[model samples]
Target: MVRSKKTEDDHIKVAKDLLLASILPNVEFDGWSSGAFEQAVIDSGVDISLVHQIAPRGAIDLAVAFHKKGDELMMHGYKQENFTELKYSEKVMQLIKLRIQASNTHKGAVRKGMSLFALPQNINEGGQLIWKTSDKIWNTLGDKSTDSNWYTKRTTLSAVYSATVLFWLCDDSDEAIDTWNFLNRRIRNVMEIEKAKAKIKKTSFGQSVFSFFDLLQKPSNEHKSGFPGYKG
Candidate 1:
């Protein structure tokens, strides 16, 4: 499998790091006790359930702190509301947008078009435009001058793998096992194609080299031998 257990672990690690960096700068994580923060929300007499949902954990804490300070900075002045509601207010909404954008900026681990999704760096020896590990096998074995099946397979693997990762990240299920199953199946298919191409290349190379030698023989002997004469 191109993305081994190590690769998956790396993905999680990078994701966590990105999340921490993104959320830490704007919101306080552990300056005060959770009870203190909660108490602050209560004292403000504002409702907080709505704000808790849209805000990242740290942002939620900051919102609670803002409420504790009794600062009507929250757009709705509801103090207990969510980030979305604050945005409904003219000034508070801008703060919410800025913070959310900051959070998203740190989300490099997500596999966006130019995100931090890692591809196999050494999959190709010649630095050709390979997108997946299977591409290396097909490119080495298959004839580029003939059918474009390998190109299709390589593209398919890259597409499926990317889709699987995206699904995994968004999977808010019990164990996120659906994404795991998808990942395993995609990896298996890529490996199978690679093995098949390796065999094909081994057989084809032998045939091609032998044909080359036969072509070097005399033109007059071409009629006697089964091999054809080289026009060149």
Candidate 2:
């Protein structure tokens, strides 16, 4: 009997998850290095060749998988919450907090993942991952934007998320209260920027300028294309 592609993919995902579980303890010390991957292969008893096939870039691939896993967990928690009563900014703040809490137990792994992604060669991938997280947050919050605001919103949120994550990693305060406060401040800063834009739009000159730019900027149909900010 021939196995289906979906079956094969599921098997690979399981293998990857096993490897990730086995590597977490080591990641704190090795920072997603080849040694960590090798150790995980031995610990997981997953076929070495299969492990390589699943993660060609070795532990770096697992690091990416770990980040994505946190996103999944965050989204799951988001769905469980009652956000209807919260303001939009409060909802966003809660989402960010949830995302951070998703990885609270694995701060060591997260810290190492940050170091691994901070490498010059991996910087672009790191940025893309953060942008993906921001996009996920906006989509979950029901953002219907298809214009340049889509890009701007994700860009601004990405900055906030990145800064919050860094602050969170260093937060040794009681229950990370400091980090939450910092996140609130960042969200308020973004809100203030939005308020400023609203004020600008109220002016005749600002309206004319925005109208001209709106005409020049084409809406991005991201659903049709895989690229997030593609405007075609």
User: Of the candidates shown, which would achieve the greatest lDDT relative to the real structure?
Assistant: 2
Q: Residue 92 CA error for candidate 1 (Å)?
A: 46
Clashes of each: 9, 0
Residue 76 miss distance in model 1 (angstroms) = 44
TM-score of 2: 0.89
**How accurate locally, in lDDT, is each candidate?**
0.38, 0.87
Query: lDDT score of model 2?
Result: 0.87
lDDT value for candidate 1?
Answer: 0.38
- TM-scores vs. true structure, each candidate: 0.27, 0.89
- The worst-scoring run of ten residues by lDDT in candidate 2 lies at 223-232
Runs in model 1 lying further than 4 Å from the true structure: 1-161, 205-232
